[model samples]
Target chain A: MSSTLLRTVPALRGALRASGAPKAAGAMASTSFVRGKATLPDLPYDYGALEPHISGKIMELHHAKHHQTYVNGLNSALQTIGEAESKGDFTKAATVAPLLNFHGGGHINHSLFWENLAPASGEGGGEPDGALKKAIDSDFGSFDTFRAQMNTALAGIQGSGWAWLVKDKAAGTLGLVTRANQDPVSGPYVPLLGIDAWEHAYYLQYENRKAEYFDAIWNVVNWKTVAGRFEKT
Target chain B: MVNIGSLWQYLALHSTLSGDSTNTNNTANNLAKMGLAAYTLPALPYAYDALEPHISAQIMELHHARHHQAYVTNLNKALESHVAAVAAGDVAAQIALQQVVKFNGGGHINHSLFWKNLAPAGSEDASVAQAKGLVAEIEKTWGSFDGFKTAFSAALMGIQGSGWGWLVKEAGNGAGLRIVTTKDQDPVVGGDVPVFGVDMWEHAYYLQYLNGKAAYVENIWNVINWRTAEERFAGRSEEKTEL
Candidate 1:
C-alpha cells in the first residue's frame, strides 16, 4: 500500500509518516532517494533471450554499456544539479539541464523498456493484456494491424529518435509520437509502448537490416509488463 | 466533438465495459526489455519485394542500405568512443561526445521506424480496419477524412525546420489525435505512444520533394494505408481498465 504512493513524489519520508505506513515511513525517513543515482537495472532474462531477432552481442552492448552510460551520466547530472542548486547557480543548473533530460531520460526509459520485453515461451512470451490490449484494439483496430503500424513507425524514424505509443496526459488520449534524441516524450503522456530505433538496439544480428529486426522484436515484447503499466496508469 | 485520440480512448472505455481478453501476460510477459539506445534494428514487416513500384525497389534498397545502415554504424562508433573516453576519465570527450551520441543515436532510432512507416504505399488493404479508424478520427476531429488531409498537410508544410508532424495520443487522458510538430529530432512523447508520423526532414524529401516539404508531405499521404491507421486507432481503443 505504501509502495503505491511513492512513485508520484520525489520524497516519501514525511508523506509516509503522515499516512502511517510506519515501518516504510521510518525507512523512508532514514534513507536517501538518490542512493546511487543510476545503476544497472536487473535484467529479467538472459542476455540472449531474444537471440536471432536481437543478438547477445547487441544486448551486452546495450545494457551493460549503453544503459550504464546513461546511468552514470544521469548520476553526474544530478550531482551537478544539486551543487548548482546549493550555490543558487541557475545558469550552472541550466547548463546541466540537457544532461538531466537526456541521460536522465535514458535511465528512466531503459528501466521501463527492460520490463517491456518478453521471451517467446507461448502465445507471445511477453505480449500485452487487459486494458492495454483493449486499448490497442480500440486504438489500432486489431493486433495484426497494430503490429504493422508499430513496425512502420519503428521503421520510419528519421535520424535518431524513438517510436512510441504514448498516452496523452491532459487530454486523456493515446497517440504515436517520435522523439528526437533522448528527449522525454512531450505532451504530458504515459508511455504505453516504446521501440528503440537506435542502430545498436539491433545492428549486430540484423546488421544494416532494420526491417528484419522489427519482425523479430515481437517475439520478445513483454506484453504482461506493458499491460500492467497500462492498468496502473 | 470527439477527437481522434479521445475517440480511441472512448472506444477503449467501451471495450473495457464489454470485457474481453485476459491481461495476465501484460504485467509479467516481457520476452526482452531491450534498450532504446542499444543494439536492436527493426526488421521489415514486408520483404524487399513487398514494397515495390510505388516505393520502388531501388529507393528502398538505397534508403535502407546506404542511409539507414550509416546511422547504425555511426551510432555504434559513438558508443565505442564514449566507452573509451569514460574509461580514460576524459570529461572533455564526454561533453563533446554528448551531442554526437544524441544526434547520431537519434538518427539511428528515427530512421529505423521510418522504414516500416512505408509498406508499398499503394496497398489499399493493409489493415483496412485501422485505416478506417484514421478516417473516422479524421471525421471526428475535422469533420471528414478530406479535412484531416488538409490539416495534416498544412501542419506538415508549416514546420520550419527538420523534424516530424505526428498524429499522436494526447497522454494519460486517452488518444486525442493532435497534430503536433517536433523540431530537430524532438520527441513527440516522453509518455504516449507514437503510432504514426510523417517525416518533414529535408532528407526525407530532398531527393523527391526537394525544397517543397508541402509537396512531399502531400504525396506521402497518397500512399497512406488508411486501413493501417484505422487499425492503430482501433488498438488505441483497447482497454486497460478491467470490466
Candidate 2:
C-alpha cells in the first residue's frame, strides 16, 4: 500500500503543477503533511467484564481482532490519501475515498459500541434516569416498547448491519434507524446507542438465535453513557 | 458500477432502439414510453449450478432468481415513479428517488455483469488465448497476472461488510486499470468501466464458504470469464482510441 501511494506521488504532483492551484497546493501541504494515524481506543473495561450477557471470547475477538483490523485499514487509507494529496494527485485520493469511509466508519461505530456497553453490574443495565427517560417516553411511548422496537429491527436485518437509537438533531426528536454494514449514521442525527446485528457479534454464543443475542445485549446496556451522549446532542 | 445518469440515457437509448416514438404526444410521451420499457433481469448465460465447487447451484439460484430479480423490480418501480416526477418538474421527488435509482440500478448492473463474468471452471474457449491486448494491459498495470490476482483478492478480503470488489478501467482520458471496492450496492460510477466484479456480500458465499471469505475469494478465480473481461477491456480501449 505504501509503495502504491509512493508511485502515485509524482503523478499527483504533476497534476497539481499543471492545474496551478496555489491555495489547494498549500492546503494539501499543510493538511496531509501532519495528519495522524487512527489508533484503536482501549476498552473502558476488561474483556470478561460484560460476561453472561457478552462473553469474554466475543469481546476479545471483536475488540482485539475486528476493531484492530479497522484501525489498521483506516490508517492505511488515510496514509494513502495523505500521500496522494501531498503529491497533488486528487485521482488517487478519490480512489481511496470508499476505503476511508468504510474503515473510518468501522472505527467510529466500534468505538461507540464499546462505550455503550458495561458489565451489567451496579453501573449497567436498567433504565435511563432523567432527560433520556423523558425523551424515550415521548418518542417510543415506554421503555418496554423501545426495547421491543429495537429488538424487532435488529432481528429483521437481512444481512450484517446495526440498529441505532439516534437523536435527529435537526428535528430534535429521537428515532430508530438501521444502517447496513459499518456505515456511520449520517449527520442531522447523532447515534446515542447502537446494537451491532452482524453475525460475528453473536454467532459464537447465540448460534442462529439472533433474537436471543438481542435480548441478552440489553442486560449490558450502559444507560449512563447513552444519557451522556443524549445530553450532549 | 452503474451510473444513474447513463441509466436515464439508457432508457432514452432503449426507446430509440425499440422505435417506440410513433405516438409523439410530447416529451412526456417519450419518457413514459422509455419508462414502460424499464429494466428487466437478464437470463443467466449458464445453468445455476454450472460453476459448481467454486460456486454452488443453490447460491446462484438465490443470488440471481431472487436477489437480482428484486433489484430489477425495485428499479422499474423507481423509474416508473421518476417518469411522473420528471414530467411534473418535481425536483424534490426526483432528488428523493436518486438513491433508490442508484441502489437498485447498481444491483441490476453489477449482478448482470457478475453473471456473465463467471463460467464453468476450466471452460476457457479459444478466444481467451487470443485476448492478447487485455493480457498485456493487465501485465502492464500489475506486473503480471498473478500480481493482479493477489491485489484483487486482497481488496475483496478487506471489505468490512456487504460490498463488491472490482477490476475497473478508470474513466477519463489516459485511463488505466485499477482495483477498487464499493460499499453496499453502489455501482461503479464516475466514468470507470468495470471489467470484472466479485460480490463480497455474505449472501454470495455464506451458504457454502460460511465465514471463510478468503476461500470464496480465491476459488472464484476458477470460474472467472476472462474472455468476457477481455472483451470489455478491448471495447473500452477502442472507445478511448476513437475519442
TM-score of 2: 0.60
Clashing pairs in 2: A12-A89, A13-A87, B1-B187, B1-B188
Candidate 2 structure quality by residue, lDDT tens digits, A140-173: 9999999999998896565578999999998999
Against the native complex, each candidate's DockQ, computed on alpha carbons, is: 0.02, 0.12
Which docking class does model 2 fall in? incorrect
lDDT of 1 by residue, B123-148 (tens): 65444344655566667888876787
Q: Candidate 2 chain A: minimum summed lDDT over ten consecutive residues — where?
A: A1-10
Clashes of each: 156, 4
Which candidate achieves the best TM-score against the true structure?
A: 2
My TM-score estimates for the predictions, one after another, are 0.45, 0.60
After superposing candidate 1, which stretches have Cα over 4 Å from the reference?
Answer: A1-36, A122-127, B1-65, B68-243
TM-score of chain A of each: 0.80, 0.84
- Report the CA-based lDDT of candidate 2 relative to the real structure: 0.80
Tell me the tens digit of each residue's lDDT in model 1 across A21-111.
8776465544334355556665666687766667776777778877887888888899999999999999999988877888877777777
Real A-B contacts recovered, model 2: 0.21
